[model samples]
Structure formats: structure tokens, C-alpha cells
Target: MELSQEELRKKFTDLSQNPFQQTKFSRNTKIRKIIKEFANFSQEKLRLENKAVKIAGRIINRIRRFGELTFADLADQSGVVQLKVVRNKDFARVSSGDIIGITGKICKTDLQEEKNKQELSIEIEEFIVLAKCQQTLPDTAHYKLKDTEERFRKRYLDLLVNTENRDILITRHKIIQSIRQFLDQKEFIEIETPILVSEASGAQAKPFITRHNKLHRDFHLRIATEIPLKKLLVGGFEKVYEIGRIFRNEGIDARHNPEFTTIEVYQAYENSEHMMNLTEKLLHYLAKEILKKEEFEFNSHNISLKENFRKMSMIAAIKEHINLDFSQVNNLEQALELAKKHNLRLEKFQKSIGQVILAFFEEYVEKKLVQPTFIYDYPIEVSPLAKNKAENKDIADRFELYIGGLEFANGYSELNDPIEQKKRFEEQTKQKELGNEEIASFDKEFLEALEYGMPPAGGLGIGIDRLIMLFTEQNSIKEVIAFPQLKSKTEEK
Candidate 1:
């Protein structure tokens, strides 16, 4: 039942006399600690002798009789404890949705069962209204706030009611913590980089544009952390890493968000091979530490982290799945013919044979990677920033880790040749001019940094949100994010 304005006003009036607006209150113990310190709950005593403790939390559940007795569960982020109150004017007006501060003594019921004996209860000596909630909570044994449109729009209430969502959020924090610990042990220094840039050029994705009024110029939210981290590499920061928010103006789906977080790591004098080994060890550590097992479930698929991640070239994967070898096709005409045979859609900007090979792999081979797999040796046409192989100029030293048919990480051996890098940027600029909306503009400053002599480096970018999804067994990226992007209510209507 929703609370009317008049009903809410009455609640406020009842709480007004207690404490008008206090700056601070004393809290001697948390609910979890109280339960931990007093484990022997079988005592017949009504109160802990000489033990006066103060606690505060929202009242979650209640059972009451008018001016006789009241029992309610007080819940904090740590845990919940039962409150025993003999009805009085002070706390008899207390409701389930209110936040209350309690000065209490610990006690236990005389129930003989071991399970009942373990339950700790608190006897309240004083009650003060911390905050009076205005609106009625929209949750019950049958109805849930999750069924309403306001769930994601108002996430604080959702966290209060949804146990699984709360667990997913807590798991996310631990996942990032474990990642930082892993990288720190490897001697990787974490750095902060600018979010606003003149041009976004690290990846092939459209950027969100914003304007600066003072300068009367435009800037873009960074689409990737690759460029600036590499500039740090050129400046003699041999090993650096950054985990920050990245923005891309793109379509939203189960795995994609406009603004998300990524961790990009760059190590001088390392190659894609070193990155692969690091990726394997990092993921295995996260699984063992966070999930507490090498095996977990995602979208009903059993993902085994123990197995050595299968490795195959992009071309090999395509040939295995679709039985078509792009290496055998030398021209765009032959590649286009093979694409048609496999029913692949062609974009106007995808005019080259290598581009067609990438399209075929995305359309046919990605979904086949149900297990943890690495698709390596990408074509140079798609991997503009990766170094080309010495023996074959057509393939770049890049690998992407895929699990549950989703791309989780992309890593590459650094392309240190200034002249070759400039050529690649020029080609990308030409493509942008030809109306490739997803292409980034040529970054002259980044090119200048490369000209200053960057060392051979290995770089990797991992989507922190998606990794959380995998660990928490959530199917959608929104489940892991606290406040996911949602269309406005008017747009929804």
C-alpha cells in the first residue's frame, strides 16, 4: 500500500519531538560485531550485565501489538539483528521503513534448540528516529519493486530489497580490488589519465562529444585509455596502468554500455606473448580468489577456468567454423564471394579483403568460442595500432580473449615504427572522411609522442564491468553497474 501525503505528514509529526536534526550520534558497536562478541545466546538473562551498546540501522521487518510488545529486525549493511521493545510512546510509533538509533543490552531467548539458541536479540532501552521515510516501500512477500519501472531509476531502494543485486555490487568491488592487488604485486604502477581529449584515437569507436565554453572548442570523452598510457610509456614510465571510465557513443545491448570502466596496462619491452601469459594468470587468480572455485556458471554455461585457454588464429577459427579460408583469397572479389556464401553482411567502408575477413570471423566464429579461448594474429587491416609480424606483413601481433561468446580482453605487441604508425593513421583518417562513423580522428599529438621514440611495449585493455559480470554470474552488463544507463521515462512512453 502506498502512503498518502497526509499519512506521511502524520509520521513526520510523531517523529518531530524525538530529535529535530542532529549533526552526529555516537555508535559504539555494529550489528555484526555484537553478534560475534556474544555467541552464547542460550542465557536466561534479559540483559548483558554492565554492557550498554549503541547501534543504528533501518527497521526491515516488524511484528507489533498495540502498546503491548513490538519486535522488529534492524538491518545495516553488515547484518541484521532482532529488536525487542515493550510498547511505550517513544518507540510504539516506530514503523518498518524508519531508520532508528537504539541504545540496547544484548539478550537471548530461553529456547532449547541449538538453532534457536544461536539467534541474538537486542532489548531496547532508548529509541531515537534517525530519519523518517516518506514514501511507502513497494515490496512484499508477493509484490516486488523489481517489477516496477522505477527499479533501476531509483537504485538505492533496489539495493535495500534485492539480495542478489546487493551481492553482485559487493562482488564487483572485490573483483576490482583483486585486480589491483594482482597488478600491484607485478610492480605495475597505477596512473591517472585525462578523460577529456582533443581527439579519441585508441580504438575504432565513435566518441561522445562535449564543448568547452571558455575555450570555445570541442573535446571528446576518451573511447579508450590506450593512447595516453602509451604516451606515459614514451616518457620513460616503463610500467604503467590506468583503470578509469571510458565513453563511447554506440548502441546498447546485454554487453555494451555508453559509459563503462576499463583497465589498460602497458609494459615496456614486452610483446603480445607476455600479455597472453599475464592474462591467463590474472583470470585464474581472480576465479580462485573471488569465486572461490575454478568453475562457475554464466548464462547456464559451465565455464572452466582450470583448462588451458584454447588458442587459435582468427583465420584458423573462421576456417574451422565456416570452412572458408580467407588466406587463400587474395582479392576483395574472392573475399566478398566467400562472405556471400556464408550470408555475411557487408558495410560500405569494408572495401578491402582483410576487412571482409574480420567481418566473416565476427559473424561466424565469435559465437563458437563458448569456452575460454584466445583468437590471435588479427589482420593488419583491422589492427591498425598493433605491430605486424616480421615474416608476414598482413597479420598483426594481437590477441583477444573470449569467454562465453563475448570479447573480454584485447592485447597487442606495440607498433614502435613512427613512419608505419603515421601511415595507418592517415588511412584511418581517409576512412573517417569516407563516412565511417565509428572511426576516430587522427591524433597528431599522439603521433608526435611516438616520434620521440617509444620502446617496444605490450599493452592490454580489459573491460572491468564485463569481468564482474562473468564472476558474479550475471548475464547483462547492467546487473553489475550500480546505475546503468536507461532511457528517460518520456522516451520509454
Candidate 2:
């Protein structure tokens, strides 16, 4: 049975005047009314219309009337609006999480105060029940979404009722947009690379493995966007970049996601110095465009883009921050002893001098880099794809940008020498054989690409998630990622 407009108005008037004591008006109602008034329509015209509107979405909130007006708000990807039932009979039957079509007048009312003046609002006139909610919503105000496990499981709800959370994800899109615009203006062609590869040849990160039944071969999810993007450089593309997902079978934390987005770019005829400048400019532009400010806060630390970034070699950084000269610590054994002196953890067996120094830097030097700094001239053992510095045979022409104690960007003057590249890949293979799990595997195809006479190019890789986190002032990467991986609730007993 359908109630007429007069009856509905009477019901609403009755509920508004002498509503049940237990029922209180929602805070959003005033805002809705303000929107209605701003739309400039009367309540009568906004009243229930006979036509059925094809409305669709998840039910955000529900009202059940025992002695008061009750209803629920439905939200789709488009937007959100409120639903109400002033009559007790209609309200008693409806529940939250119901999908429904609402037909009503687009009315206006002065419900919300803005700038010392009451403002008009908008709302759905009358709603038809589509699907009823079965389970009760978790307490959303205080007890809601505190558990990391549950939050990921109920990501939809987390996005709802949390505007700040939604904004973080929206900001990520803007960050990507800014990068695309920046690169496109610089004539860098955007490209897509295969996600599943015969061999992963980029970063020293564990790959997620899968077996292809038809091919009867094992394949790995690409660990980095480095190899293929560089192959384009060999093919004579002057500039190229890929903003895409890379998979790594790694531990999860506030900083790390198993699958994450990275932007890898390469420019022919440029070196590490050019890459450093590009890194600074790109990041500064992203911060300015996406955040609309050159300064922001992250982890209680204020970061400014007004000044040029501090640049220091890895050895120089160790000397300045650790007070231990890398010149004095000449070998792996001495470096390991120094690490132990600083109470830094490392494998008991033989490790390369590069690994020992890196472990020491991670422990002692990285945290002290609270501002934007370019830590360059990395040890050749760790940077296999980077060219060796001409003056220092031990250090590669690589630089990593750090801000707020998080590594944001890494770039290098690429190793274009096919023979030297082969030797470096072999070293990586040797390291892998020695039980270092995160070592890059030898890729014959990538070496073949280099052998085809690749140009001297500069390349960079920036962790998109971490960059978004910093710009949005979010403490956790999950906040900026819309559907970050969560432990499956079904797996829980």
C-alpha cells in the first residue's frame, strides 16, 4: 500500500513535533536541509513522486522506528543522500543496508548555518525499500575500525563515514595525475610492462611465484618496473616511464604493502645528476599541485620544499652522522664489528662490505634524515644497474631521496656497458646462491637488451604509495590505498 503526499506530510509533521524520546535527529540532517535550500525548491515539490527512480548503492545507515521516525541513507560511488520514514509503521519494517529507490521532490530548506546565515539543503523525497540490511553495523564512532584486520575486511564501511580516509585515496589519484602530466610535458612516453615474467631482473625483492599449468613453467610477478623501461631506452625511446603495480612477497607494515605502485622513468643521455634534479622537481611539483602547499607534516615532522635538498655521499653521510669514517672501516669484517658496536643486527656468516655498510646506514643514518636529502654514491655491490663513479670505483652513481625518515625516490646513471652489466647480474646470482633472498636474479633477456647497444641513460623509481602517504599526512600506507590487502575475515574462526 502506498501513502499519499498528504498522509506522508501528516506523518512527518507528527514525527517532527512529538517524535519518540529515544529518537534524535542526525547531525547530517541539518546539512541535508542546507543543501536542499541551496538547491532552491520547496518541500511540497520535493515530496514523494509516483515515478520510480532507478537508484542503486550500498545502504550506509538505517533507521528502525519502534516509537520514532526511522530510515537509512544509501550511498553509491556517485554520492550519498539520506532516507527517512516519519511513520512508525513504515519504519518498523525497514533495516540498515537496504538498497532502495527514492522518489521525491527536490526540495529546499534552511537547515544548516553557514557564515552566520542559515543555508538550504537537499534530500531524497521518499524512498522505496530495495534490499534490507541483515547484520548490525559495527559501532562507527569510537569502537569502529580500530582493528587493522577488521578495517581492511570492511573497507567499504571504512570509506563511508570517514571523509578523511576517502580524501587520502583521492589525493593518491591526484599524485598519479601530477606525475603523468609532468612526464607527458617532458615528452616521456607512458608504457605498460608484463606483470608476470620468466625472470624478475630489477630490485632485490622477493617475488610472488606462480605456476603456469599450460606452459608447465614457473613465473614470478614483476618485482620492479626497472628492466622493461630500460629496454625501451635501448630501443631508442628518448624518455619513458611506467606507473604501475609491482608485487613482492614481503612482510606487511605501516610502510610496506605486498603489492605497491612505483613510477620508473628513464631518460637517454642523462646521468645521475640529471636524475637528481628531475627527482627534486617532480616531487616538488607533485607536492605543490596535489597538496596545494610546499610544506606539510608527516609523523610529527614538518617538511618544507622551499630549500634545495641536502646532498651527501653514502660515505660522507656515515662520517657526518655516525662519526665513523668509512675510510677507516675498509673491509666487511671491520664494518661488521662496527655494526655490532652500534648493536645493529646482521647475519653471522660472511657478508659483503656493501651489505655491512648498508645495514649500518639503515640502523644509524636513515632515521636522522628527517629532511629531504639525496644520499648518493651507493656501494656497487647493492646497485647492480648503476654506473660506477669515475672517481670512486667502489661507489655507484646512485642517489636515494629521503624525507621524514622514509625513502621516497631512487635513481642512477644506468650501467649501459653490456659486459659490466653481465658481471653485475652474475654477482647478484652469486649472492642469491649464498642465501640472500632479496637478490635480483640473472635475466639473460635484459642482458641481451643491453648488448643491443643501449644509450647512456638516467633512471628513477619512486614508491608512489609512500609519496602519497607523506603528501596526505597519513601515518599508514593503508589509509592512502583504497583496497589495501587485509587478512581475510573468512579465514578467521
Candidate 3:
């Protein structure tokens, strides 16, 4: 039952008072440490040693069988361990959801029906309530809450009760750690880029705008960590990477979030092929390091992270998926006719044949890519920051890594020509003027940086949250995110 505020205060006031005037418990060991220390120790060895230890964790479960003895499970972040406590007035009052400190000696417990079987346990000598639980938790501990919103709203409670949720978060952390370690080992320097910019450009997405009263100017939360990281490339860094948050004024869906995390990596003197190969290698390494295997299961699909991922051009994937010959789409009118043939809608600003090709792919081909595939040679109109192919000016030297029917990574052969870059920005400006909300702005400073002569480079961006979702077999991006944005409950009707 949920306790009232006054009742909770009274319970806490009583808990705060110490009758014995004893010193508060100081934790010298964790429950996980205790388990690890005695994991290999036998019953005879534990009895002979009688190791005294101080451990701290939350009381997750309580079993009352004998009149004088109680068995409660104590859980820390690492794992849970069994605690055997002798019943007393204070001990009997201890309930689940209470943070506790215990000083105990290690021993082995032998239950009935198994005379020779014994398990390691802690025999409590001193116990104190480190923190008392005031409000009651959800009734179900092992089961999920019926309201999915509650899971994200009260993540602490979710983590406390659901081991699977905690494991997904832990896996997310390890994936990021592995990324940093992998980049560092590969001689890539990690760098920090600005989160707020005068103009949000880099990817074709609307930005969250904010104003600064002191400066009397507006700033946009970064849409992607792309332009600033490229500025580092212009400043002569061979390889640099940043894993940061990006905000987008866009829709929220199963795979997308208003605010998300991505890692943008740039390597000087590299091409699109180099970035694709690096992407393949990095994910392969992450699979082995994080999952302890070369394969993982997601949505009933057993994905293999082994070598030799399939590579296909954007037009080829379109053809393979729907038998559409996009290579013949050389002009806007022809492309529109083909799109109309396929019943795919096109925006007014998407007047180029390349844009129409992209529209067809998004509508008909993207979901068909169920395995690890690199869809390369994108339409130049869709990839503003990428270098154009020398042989075909209509297509950019770019690729997007797709796995489990979701785009995980995007990359390109960097465009360093200032003149060409300005022209591309002007084209985007025209599109934005034509009511294309998902278009990048013209960053004059980024253009100026290009004039200083950046070398031919490769750049890649991976949505860290989406990758975590895939690794943890979570379908919604919210499941991997600890605290996702939700509509306000206090809004007026």
C-alpha cells in the first residue's frame, strides 16, 4: 500500500533515531564483491575461514519461513546475494525496497531435501537502514508495467525491478566504451564539438531554436555533429570522433527520437570505401567485444557481424528490391514519371532526378534491406556534404549502412572544394525557400573553413542509440534511452 506523506515522515523520523548511539555503517564491500570473493570457496573452507565482511545494497526480496530466521535477497548493481538474518524487532520490520547496510560473516547454508547440497550465504551480525522506502513500488517486480509510458517516466523503478532493462542500459554503456577504446587504439583522437550553433546545418533536419537575451541572437541546438567535426578536419586532424547529443524538430517514431545520440568520425585522406570498410570492421569488433560472439538476435533475425558485408549501389538496391531501373532516370521529368508509375509521392522542392530516385528508394527499397548492407553512390541532391563522383556528377560518393531494416550509419567521401560547397549550399537554400523543412542552412563559416584547403577525407556518423537498440534487441529507440521525452501530463485540455 502507498503510504501517505505524514505516515512516511513519521516512519523516517523514527528510522533516523538510533537507540544504541552506534556509529553509522561504512561500506567496505559490495554484494557482488562478496559473491565473487567466495564463489570458488567450498563449505568447509568458508566455515574454517569465517570471513567477516561489510556489504551494502537494497533489499529486493524477503522470505519469512522460520520464526527466528529470515532470508532476504540483497541487490547491488553487479548482482544479488542471499542474506540470512536473525529476527529482531528492527530486522523483522525490514521490508523490500529498503536500502540497507549489513555487516556479516560468510557461511554455507544447507536446506532440507538436499543433505549434501550447500550454498554460500551471509550471516548478518549488524544491520541498519541506510535509507527507508517511503512510497510503495509497483506491485509486479518480475513482470512489466502495463503502461509503457510509466516505464520511461519512472526509469529508476524500472531499473530496480527489471533486470533486462538494466542489462540493455549496461550494454549501451559498454558499446560506447568499446567505441572510445576502439577509436583510441586506432590512433583516432576524440574531440568535443559545440552543441549550440548560430545556424544548425550538417544534416537535412529542422532544429530546436533558442534565444540568448544577452547576445540578442538566436541559437539552434545542433542537428548533427557534422560541420564542426569537419572544421577539425580542416584544422589538420588526421582522425577525430565525437559522440554527442543531437536535437531535431521532427517526428518521434519507433526508430527516431526528438533528441538522440550519434558518433561522427572523420579520417583525413580517406574515401567512402575506407569509411565503409572501417564501419564494417568496427561493428564486427563491437560484436565480439560486447556480445562475446560474432552474431546477435534482433526481432527474430539472427544477424551475422562476420566479414564481407554486401555492398550495392543505391540504384542497384532499388532495382533488386522492386525491379525498377533507376539508371535510366537521368532527368527530373523522367524520374517523376517513374515515381508516378510506382505511385510514390514527391515534394515540390525535390525537383531533381536524384531526389526522385531517393524518394523511390525510401518508399520502396529501404525496408527490404534486412541484413548488413552498404547502399552506396547516393544521389547528389540528397547528400549535400558528400563529394561528387568523378565519373558521375549526378551521384555522390556516399554510403549508408543498413542492418535489420534500419539505417545505422551514414558516411561520405568528404567534399573539400569551397566553390562546389557554396553551390551545394545555395541549392539547399533554394530548397528551404521552397518549403523544404528538412533542409540544412548555409553555414558561411563552414564554407570559409573549406577555403583553407581540407584534404580528401572520409566521414561517418552512427546513431549510438539506434545501434544500442539493435545490439540489445530493442525495437523502439526509447527502450535503449534512459529518459526519453514524453508529452506533458499537466497540459490543459
**Cα lDDT tens digits for candidate 2, 1-493:** 4457786556444332322232322122333333434344445454543222334455554452335544455565445555444553644444455454544433333333444332222244454454444456543334456677676767877776565677778778888998999999999999999999999779989889999999999999999989988889888788999999999999888999899999999999999999999999998898778778888899779999879999998888988987888877777778778877888888632387887778778878998898899999788888999999999888899999999988999999999998998898887777777787888778899988888888999999999999988898888988888888865566665
lDDT of residue 305 for candidate 2: 84
Q: Candidate 1 regions off by >4 Å? A: 1-10, 16-20, 36-40, 45-51, 110-118, 140-142
Candidate 3 segments exceeding 4 Å error: 16-25, 39-44, 63-65, 112-116, 139-143, 490-493
Give the candidates in order of lDDT, highest first. 3, 1, 2
Q: In lDDT terms, how accurate is model 2? A: 0.76
Error of 2 at 326 (Å): 1.1
Q: Please report, as a residue range, the 10-residue window in candidate 2 with the lowest summed lDDT.
A: 19-28
lDDT of 1 by residue, 1-493 (tens): 6778998778777774644475566898899898888755446543535467899988875444545666778888777888878756667677777888989888764333455344578878997888876666544334456553487788888888775688899999998999999999999999999999999889999999999999999999999989999999999999899999999999888899899999999999999999988999999999999999989898678899998999999989998998887778888889888878778898778888888988988888897788999999998988889999988998999999999989999999989888999999888887877788888778889889999999999999999999999999989898899998988899989
Clash count per candidate: 0, 16, 0
Q: List the residue pairs that clash in candidate 3.
A: none
Every model's Cα RMSD, please? 2.4, 7.9, 2.5
lDDT of 3: 0.86
